[model samples]
Every structure is written in C-alpha cells, then in structure tokens.
Target: MATITLTVNQAIRELSDIDPTTPLLWVLRDHLGLVGTKFGCGKGLCGSCTVHLEGVAVRSCTMPLASVAGRSVTTIEGLAGEGDELHPLQESWIEQDVPQCGYCQAGQIMSAAALLNGNAKPSDDDIDTAMSGNICRCGTYQRIRKAIRAAAEKGGAA
Candidate 1:
C-alpha cells in the first residue's frame, strides 16, 4: 500500500494506503465517490468507463491507479462548466434526445467532449470515427452524431 496524488477535475486529490495496481475505475467510483464513470464489461473494450486523462479519452477500468499518479483525470462530473452550467454538448444532447437508457451517456458524452476539444468542426466521418469506441445499446448513434454537429455549431468545441 502506498500514497498517490493526482489532479481530478481540476482539484488535487491524494489517495493514501491503497494498492497502486488497482484499476482507476474502482478508485473513482468506490474511493473517490465519483460514480459518473460507470463500470461495464470490466474489460477495456466497452467505453462505459471512458474518462479524460490529460484531455484525452481513456478507459478507466483497465487503467491502473499508478499510471494516473501525477496526471490529470476528468470524469463526467467535471464535464460541466463553472456553476454547474451544462456544456454545450450536453445541451445539444437534450435537444437532440440523445439518450434512451442513459447508462452509456456519460461515457459517450466524455468521448464526444474529447473529440470536440480537438476538432471544433468535425465531419460526419470524424464523428463516427471518434465515437466508434463507445457503444449505445439503445442504438442512438444518429442522435449522437446530430448532437455533436449541433454542439460544434454552437462553438462547443471552442
């Protein structure tokens, strides 16, 4: 057991006396009380555990706590702007009716946020490629794409 420190959602967090090899998913969900990053397919294949590591999308389930030491991590809870203002993509999501079951929406939104961070105006192909890793059993791919495009138009990427 050891201590590890990292930035989470712009806040410095220190985890003590924990196994460094533990998956970051557990640390975020169980230890840190951030349940927005869900658990699905324990393996890294499913994007349900997606979060941002240094502004890049990553699967928290397979990412070791040690790997995130001294790194910046962003979970769905941090996706919103200050004062709990919804990110543009989030507003677009509601406008587009993107979620059905909503179980996968957080990860889906996180992945979309990363894409928008890099490409303010992404093509349909780009959206498809960036979102291919995430799976929505509700089959809301079309809505997802539309939401991304709408958010881009609203300067969500900026």
Candidate 2:
C-alpha cells in the first residue's frame, strides 16, 4: 500500500494506503466514487473505462494507481464546463443524439476530445483511426463520427 497524490478534475487528491497495482478504474469507481467512467471489459481492449491523463485518452482499467501518482486525471463528469453550459463535445453529442444505451459515450467523447485537441479539423479516416479502439455496442458509429465532426466545427476542444 502506498499513498498516491493525483490531480482529479483540477483538484489535488491524496489517496492513502491503496494497492499500487490496482486498476485505476476500480480506484475511480470504488475509492473516489467517480462512476462516470464505466466498466465494460476488465481487459484493456474496451474503451469504456477511458479517461484523460494530462489530456491523453487512456484505458483506466489497465492503468495502475501508482503509475498515476502526481498526474492529472480527468473523468467524464469533470469534462463538462461549470454551470448549465456543457462541454462542446457534450453539446454536439446531444445535438447529434449520439448515444443509444449511453454506456460507451463517455469514453467515446473522451477519445474524441483527444483527437480534436490534436486535430481540430479531422477527416473521417482520422476519426476512425483514433476511435477504432473505442467500441460502441449501440452501433452509433455514424452518429459518433458526425458528432465528432460537429464538435470540431464548433471548436469543441479548442
């Protein structure tokens, strides 16, 4: 057990006496009580537990808590801007009606955020390449792509 300190949603968090090797997904959901990051497969193949580590999208299920010590982690709940105004991606998602079951949307949005951050104007192939790892069971691929493009046009990540 080690005490790990990390920035979560712009706030510094000191995690005490936690198993170092424990997956960050479990730590976020169980310990920190941030349930927005879903659990699809415990394996790294699924993107359901995706989160941003210093603005890069990563699978939380495969990340060790110790590895994130002193790093900045952002979950879906923290992605939205304060007050009633939503993140541009979230707005585009709603405008595009991008979710079916909504389980995978958070991860999808996070991945899109990373993509748009790097490339504000991404082509379809670019989106496909970046989002290939995030599986949406709702089969909302077309809508997802459209929403991402819309977010880019709206300067979602910019």
Per-candidate TM equals 0.98, 0.97
Model 1, range 66-154, lDDT digits (tens) per residue? 99999999999999989968999999999999999999999999999999999999999999999999999999999999999999999
Candidate 1: Cα lDDT at 70: 100
Q: How close is candidate 1 to the true structure, as a TM-score?
A: 0.98
Error of 2 at 128 (Å): 0.4
TM-score of 2: 0.97
Q: Which number leads on lDDT?
A: 1
CA RMSD of all predictions: 0.8, 0.9
Q: Write the per-residue lDDT of candidate 2 for residues 1-158, one digit (tens) a residue.
A: 88889999899988898889999999999999999999999898979999999999999999999899899999998988877778899999999989999999899998999888789899999999999999988799999999998988888783
**Clash number for each model:** 0, 0
Clashing pairs in 2: none
